[model samples]
Target: MVTRIEWLDAGLELLATEGAPAITIERLTDQLGVTKGSYYHHFGSAGGFKAALMEYFEAQFTTRLIDTIDAENAKPRAKLEHLLRLVLADPDNAALEIAVRAWALQDPDVRATQERVDAARTAYLKELCRGVGADVDPDRYAQLLYLILIGAEQVLPPIGRAELREIYNLTLRLID
Candidate 1:
């Protein structure tokens, strides 16, 4: 049987595969091998489904990371390293982020949600910087770090796992 989580998961896969423009009740129903009734029962409308997808994205990537970092018993540097490793390990997650960013350029609601996610991510990174006794301006450092991470996904060749782990370690050292 279809569930809310299943719908969101399917939406994410559809978003990654076809971009936001492909998100429709009919399309989702086809993707899930279900009917319109299931979609309507879960989401009320296509707009509601999109809204839910945005919320799910924010919760999965931003809120969960922040919670993990805040609750980590490791040292600040270790926590930062762990965060970097977790993010860099997931290439598919990076692709979804890029897809959402592309969609945001056209949709106001999506742009708003993307803005919130960026702000939250930067704030979390800044907090991590402070925790690590960074002498640099935490806010600025956070922006630079986040920009590097996002920019790498956009412009650089895909990094190997070892290379990514090295970079993560080096970044933590630089911040510390």
Candidate 2:
């Protein structure tokens, strides 16, 4: 039997594969091979389902990226580099980002959440820049790094893990 978490996961998969327009309660229920009653048991309505999805995405980001970066043993530089590598390594993240961006265009709540995520990521990067004693403003460097990382997701070819590590190392040297 599928759990509520499973339904949310399926929703994300559907969004990633078919785009936001394709994710309706009916479609999701059909895809999950469950009835509308089952979906409603988990989420009260279509809006409720979307709200849950946004929350789910936020939690996933928190667990997968935010918490990882905040580990007590990880240095600031290591955190920043790990963030870059994680973003680059995830095959689905680029698409997920694109989908969320599209959703944000229509939903104020989503736009706010997106901004919050960007802010959190930027704050972390700024701390890393400060730790490294970079001459430029940490916030500015953080925004620059954020743009570069997003650009890499959109424009760069698939990079091997070792190659990405090398690139991150070289980029850090430039910043410092």
Candidate 3:
């Protein structure tokens, strides 16, 4: 039997590949090679499924990732570097991330979730800045970092690894 997580994973894949409008019960069921009964069993309706998807996205991308970074024993600089590298290397979530951003432009629910995510992400970056003993205002640095990450994701023709590294290195130097 397909679990709720499986259903959500399929939803995420569909969202990444086909955008927000493709997140219908019928389409997801077809994508998973399942029936509508299974979809309703877990999510009850299309709205339910979409709500779950947003929750899952926030938990996985923002909450869990921040928790992992905070829990790490590495030095602040190292922690930030690791996160930068991870973000730069990530390809699977790029499309989904952009799709969600687009969804936020029209949907208040999505916009609220995106706001929460942005706040959490920026706050974490500020924590890292403080941890590294940076004299600059942590909030400002956090904003800049968050902007770079989000902007890099949105830019047409994704930024190359070399450019990513250069940006990361420059940010690290400024922080240090």
RMSD of each: 1.7, 2.5, 1.4
What is the per-residue lDDT of model 2 for residues 1-176, given as tens digits with 9 covering 90 to 100? 66999899999998888888889987888888888888888888888888899889877864458787776587677777777777667667767877887888898988888887777777777877788666777778778777765665555574444665576677678765
| Per-candidate count of clashing residue pairs (backbone under 3 Å) | 0, 0, 0
TM-score of each: 0.92, 0.86, 0.93
**Candidate 1 per-residue lDDT over residues 15-69, each given as its tens digit:** 9888988888888888899988988898898789989999999999899987977
Candidate 3: global Cα-lDDT? 0.83
Q: Which stretches of candidate 1 lie over 4 Å from their true place?
A: 156-162
Point out where model 2 deviates above 4 Å.
154-169
Error of 2 at 159 (Å): 8.7
Error of 3 at 37 (Å): 0.7
- Candidate 3, residues 110-165, lDDT tens digits: the string is 89999988888888888887787887877788788888877877898977666867
Residue 120 shift from truth in candidate 1, angstroms? 0.6
Report how far residue 137 has shifted in candidate 3, in Å: 2.3
Query: For each candidate, what is the lDDT?
Result: 0.83, 0.77, 0.83
Clashing pairs in 3: none
